[model samples]
Target chain A: MEYRKIKDEDEDGAGAGADIEGLRGKAFSSSAVSNMPPVERSKWKRKTIVTLALTVLTSSQAVLIVWSKRAGKYEYSVTTANFLVETLKCALSLAALARIWKNEGVTDDNRLSTTLDEVSVYPIPAALYLVKNLLQYYIFAYVDAPGYQILKNLNIISTGVLYRIILKKKLSEVQWAAFILLCAGCTTAQLNSRSDHVLQTPFQGWMMAIVMALLSGFAGVYTEAIIKKRPSRNINVQNFWLYVFGMAFNAVAIIIQDFDAVMNKGFFHGYSLITVLMILNHALSGIAVSMVMKYADNIVKVYSTSVAMLLTAVASVFLFGFHLSLAFFLGATVVSVSVYLHSVGKLQR
Target chain B: MEYRKIKDEDEDGAGAGADIEGLRGKAFSSSAVSNMPPVERSKWKRKTIVTLALTVLTSSQAVLIVWSKRAGKYEYSVTTANFLVETLKCALSLAALARIWKNEGVTDDNRLSTTLDEVSVYPIPAALYLVKNLLQYYIFAYVDAPGYQILKNLNIISTGVLYRIILKKKLSEVQWAAFILLCAGCTTAQLNSRSDHVLQTPFQGWMMAIVMALLSGFAGVYTEAIIKKRPSRNINVQNFWLYVFGMAFNAVAIIIQDFDAVMNKGFFHGYSLITVLMILNHALSGIAVSMVMKYADNIVKVYSTSVAMLLTAVASVFLFGFHLSLAFFLGATVVSVSVYLHSVGKLQR
Candidate 1:
């Protein structure tokens, strides 16, 4: 039964590229309406600029972070960069929200019937992710960093299993083999690390990190599954808006707490600037994501963006003049290759 | 055009359950054999027992780890349980390799196609997954534990964006809202932490964790996309065989490594034991995944299994006597709720 599925899929794979391209052309036809109202056309034009600006800005920042890390500047620089990037992320997310807000209730050109309803609407996946993050933060406060990192890698393995089980997707020999390699690489990196001995107290941070990774996988897988069930919507834009919404929630929560301390904090002392930037960044990312979804496949988009994320991470290590270990480099390389291969596979077939 | 696709999909979605189920049943009946050779039948029975045993043991071990962590005994105890679980994982993986070796080319009882060569071959995704794992291990060695954990959660957000871009799937409003909820939870978790204001050095571990999570998403999305294109050959055991193949590679690698250190490394040390367990874990997981694919939808399976993973993770934290901050707890709760809601939605119309 399964064997036949694979054969059919392979046969289809050859022609799929063309099919997808055709789908894209048709998908965008509605959006490409001629003689649109000036207001709508202007909105579209502005959005186009916003999207271009974000892609360029993000791409540049990603590159700069990578370069700076290699240059090895001040000790605080990495942290600063992280903060800046995160702030930028927040802003991009907000921008995405703005785009969504502008076109709220606009139905998708292709909408599918879903099981979603007001009563059944729930936020478990997202909530679980947050819980996982909070747990990690608490754990980090108590544990060693490297220990946590090792555990974090388990997410891939876990997700690989989950993907097969949940998605009912058949993995090729290469896909299966690659995941093993990834696990092997992670183990190797850990074994080579200095702290192989028992910990006085297990690093809470490390535990949290692992939990976070797992939660992330869960959320991601669920999102993918659910998204597939719906009609093709403005995914990129929606993602950004979601971020914006999340940020707004965070900001509001912060406001109810030690607002003064945060306002007078060292890095983001100016609320107005950070707030505005955060919104803009989030919104822009949404648009960019939407554009990517509109044009490419999920694997391709993810793989490409992950490369950017990976570079950003590597830059953090060197740019901040942080101490580097051999195992760390090995692990990073392993991860980079895995992401690249996965993305490439998606693109090819 | 987009609208029509949505309509088509909706029509398909509503009737697909029956269509697919009916198709599967028909395929099964056509391929169903009345006179199985005694040799093959016996072999299958044995294989099923072995698979079941391995799954039960590993799952129990996983559960045990959670329970021990919740009980807050010596950290070593939990580690030991985890180690056993890891060994089981290794053994399971190896066992899978054995299965593939023994069963390769013997397509029987329900393959979509009888020949593996009929499918398009691709190794890029597998290689990419391998790289992802290596990177994860590298980062894990350097970062604090909790920090690593939180970073991993970023998988959810990344997966959402990637799915939209790569799969051209649409996300519903609720799922989109859930994404926002997750981000908020993570941000709150970050803010709620009482860690030092200034970093002494860059958190390499945390970065690595995030990198691993991102890689997993990339690999996972690609795997799903590819598998969707290639239907499974029916034997309901392709995933099993794939794992078997993957395990073969892993076992060879493990055996080639110097066993002296691993075998004599104090408690739970034994290269042979580790090797065995790893094979078993991988093998069962692979086959089990195929079973899931055969019986259920992708998102539903993922969503359900994720619940189990999260519950186990949370259980581990409490069992281990890890500290739980209020805000962190709240965030985690929200994330869990969001995921739950999403999963529940899948079960609906």
Candidate 2:
């Protein structure tokens, strides 16, 4: 996902008469975007479809995780086993990509030079992701699925600020307003007046959510820099090193917190059909994000993720019978509108 | 008060490097502004100072009104008396402006016009304002002072929308985003989780606030059109007709709503030092608005009025012991920032 293509859409996309739906012709069809190769239309379509898939996978993961649990608690060492599954999934993706490159006779330095020097750069973001993923699970203890979905949008603010600081990306005034609106929306959503306990996200949940957003934002910007620093490197090769470090970090996490529990209960103690599906959803969503980035831009990813939030909320309402408060609904509406406005700003840039 | 001077300030005032503090020549001083006469520096300074004074006067009115009342109720009809006071104030202002014209030895048709044709246009806005002002008095029956002050910001949205509809003034995407944020902020402010009854605006209050905002927006935009349609017309001459019609409408309101009550208890039943001061504040604020408009722009008025909202809230806390909820504070903060963003958009335009 870090190795993404970025192309300027029509200014009309900024509501400046931008053909937001098509956004072709003189607007962005010209091959003038810095650092971006001319995009093939089919590739763009494929990436968009993949992003749509990512949306479904991401939205379903939380609901599925909740469904997999019994009495609102997970039977497994939720912390220990997910990393092992993710490790296997990453290895599989790398194997597939390697085979494809070999068939194409791509034995260049970028492909073969996956030395320790290059692999060494992956650990920091991997470590950040490790903490972030762990928090994702822990956060469930404090908030319901719908509430968690709303809180997840707080990541956008941290990501936007970090993107500006680390990448020196200039966001327009509209873009800044959009970011503020998104933050305010997420805050407003949290302020939902739910007298019931089932849908409320507590103060502890908010703290954990903020930490998670920060860690993820740092990891994301850092990873993006690494990917863009040497765009010639095969994305699969980079993912290989990143996954290796991620697995190593997750293994360390398992050792520190869930080691004894996993040892006694066995690695597959709480494994069930739904748990397997959730793990699959998680792994596939990760792959889908990378696939989308191979063609589409960050704005697409942002839009899809925001849509996923509303999808998760609606799903949670139906599947878990969660209550959607008026404030949450209005706040989410604002968040969605702000996301659109932010994308418009993205096109302007 | 409707008559005023108009000039473009520095684009920096829009927060766009617009010398928000001293936007001067080579910026707005180049005298290229369409329909605007070149301004003297001293005149601009005087107008801005008057604007500041207007802010102070506007903020104090609500506080003074609450102080003037006994047990949160007014002995006289609030609806009937304000218009009478406003009429007298407008008349005084018109008289002063007439003297200024006489001193300048100016008696052009633009300065002397008081025809039925000219005066007729004034009644429409006066009527709209009459209805709006009546609602202002009735709304207190539904909401408290602090909440009402927050809700008053709903006017921004209506004003923005109507400005576009009536004036065909193009708002940039950022300005549109800012407007949305302003609305979101106002709504969020209303959602404050104040346990006490004194700081909350109920559902009916929301409805009334919206209506007030719409009425004021229409009246404002329409009045601006009338004022700008003939740039050379002396503003004082125009204001005289507006005042005359406003007084007429205010009298009609008295007849329809409080004929028996006023006839029996007399118009001065609720008279107090504070009441007189409140009327003075209201009248002076109106004059100050026109005075500021002569040299400044709508953005300056907006900034002053929003600041006045905060001033009102703070003052309410000390004088009436109003509770300032966390949500209200956060919401007002967002609204303030959005106002700045919107002003920046204005500068861009």
Candidate 3:
């Protein structure tokens, strides 16, 4: 991570062909990266595969949870799902492997000192993101869907303001306007009546979504921090470490809360369909996190996330025979605009 | 834009800071750029302003349509919104003016032959995007929110494959894995629910979403083409020109088909807010396009778009009161991961 700052600035700064090449070569040549004993590489690879397996496993558990809830099996599904969830425990072992592997990369102990100094010291933001995701799920457990959606709008403002403060990023005029419009879109969606009932009584869900937004903001801030600390590190490495830590934390909590349930559930759920899907989903998440960490800025990562949601919003209406009022569409569009503007604002700044 | 190929490849390589500066200065001082008369500068500025206005005006009109549909005060809100959207247009114009007003230093503009001729030209991909957006909105008008949300996952696949074929950009293992996982996530979402209620006549909505996805893909390709053609233009200029062309096209379409519907509906439906928001979105889009085009690559823009969608998805769940089953949460997470990977993949390529 530690390197001399090459101060030359072109209009199209960095990421030119040469820069990308230089980075790759530097990583490959460093004794820190190169002297990885085969044992470490194998261990690292194994952990990545296990994490991928957990992702796929989760998909089936999700299906079971939904189907079981419909069949008056909430408690049963929770218990059953917990068993399926145990597959994620493998992620912990993977985490151990990663820590060991990363340690192995430290051949030049002196270099570690320099790298440490070069990297952002703040782990608070990353911690906040982990907390945020956990709370988001917690709220999801309690709150109805529409309510969760609306509260999410707060991120439009929260992240915008946070990026400004933490990343020292500036906002453009259009970005501010976009942010306001996004909020307005949320207001309009609130008025649409479709999501009204779902959001009403579950105050806890509402709180969680709010917390998630804030956490997401913090995650965003920390993501930038990590990227800035080691501009040349493979983003996959950054992402893997984050997941390794976050998943391990989550697995620990699950085990502590329901040790018996974790031990009892089947390794693979009924029909095998749901289990397969869960594993795939987990794998996807792993891949996406790694990629985002590698190439784009955190804000850009956020922007892509927004667009994907918009696409899903549009699709949900037709695929599920669910009602999508003009209000929903309008709100979604506004949110899209806001997200788009946020990115533009970054550029303008 | 073209310049003589660097005959001395060694000096032209990295570390040739002085060469870059000389080129920058030389390019700025070229008669092709600086020799323009005052009349030409004013003319170019006017055209740029007009182009900016056109994009803002058209996009505002589109947003106003959604707002009016929601507000039921179409005639009033449309106009107010239009006015609101125009504010951004004005800001962009002002920015351009400020840049020119502040242009006191040596400016070079040597007319150099461009090397775009060396690359293969493909217009089919570009034309495809135009048709895609129209189809997306058309589907949107009919589909339920949730249905549309699920189907949009196709975009990651679409963009990646297209890039592979058209740009010959290699995909990484993480990217391939992410795409597979994203597709799996979509499949899981579709499976988790009962399939009893397919849209008997889904042609209108489903087709539209499909088309929109296609168009978005095309737009992605078209932008890449522009970038490939002029590898050296400033990102701002490239983005500005893209918007200029896109806005011009959109504006003309509006003028020809539903100028009365757009303007009259906007005015009667609260024209000020709708107009202002639309203009703002357009201006932001323009600036974003320019920045991505100049500083980053088109894929960077793609990554941003994806991140924005991710944010929207998570936010929409609560905002719209959509049911957030385990599957939805997991799927969204997967989507987020896919976005990050895609961004990083592009960077690697």
**Tens-place lDDT digits, model 1, residues B87-181:** 44445544554565467744443333335553333233444544554464466456544444445445656666766777677665444544544
Give candidate 2's TM-score.
0.75
**Residue-by-residue lDDT tens digits, candidate 3, B180-213:** 5444344333323432123333776656655565
DockQ of 3: 0.03
User: A60-128, model 3: which lDDT tens digit per residue?
Assistant: 323333443344423332223322332343354356446755666533321222344434343444356
What's the DockQ of model 1? 0.02
lDDT of 2 by residue, A1-349 (tens): 1100010010001001111222332244444323344465544455546766767776776566557553343566655555755586578667877786768766653364566777778798777776666566677778765566456556777777877888797788767776676666655655644422422467888789888877877776677676666666776766666667767777887787678988998877866676567566666666665554444434445555655655677788898898665455546756765766665666665
The most accurate candidate by DockQ is 2
- lDDT of candidate 2 over B176-242, digit per residue (tens): 8766766666556656443234334577877898888888778767776676666677777666666
lDDT of 1 at B35: 48
Best candidate, lDDT: 2
**How many collisions per candidate?**
155, 10, 129
Error of 3 at A62 (Å): 17
Higher-lDDT candidate of 1 and 2? 2
How big is the positional error of residue A128 in model 3, measured in Å on the Cα after superposition?
35
**Residue A62 shift from truth in candidate 2, angstroms:** 3.9
- Name the regions of candidate 3 deviating beyond 4 angstroms: A1-349, B1-130, B133-149, B182-211, B262-269, B313-325, B339-349
Q: State residue B269's C-alpha deviation in candidate 2, in Å.
A: 2.6
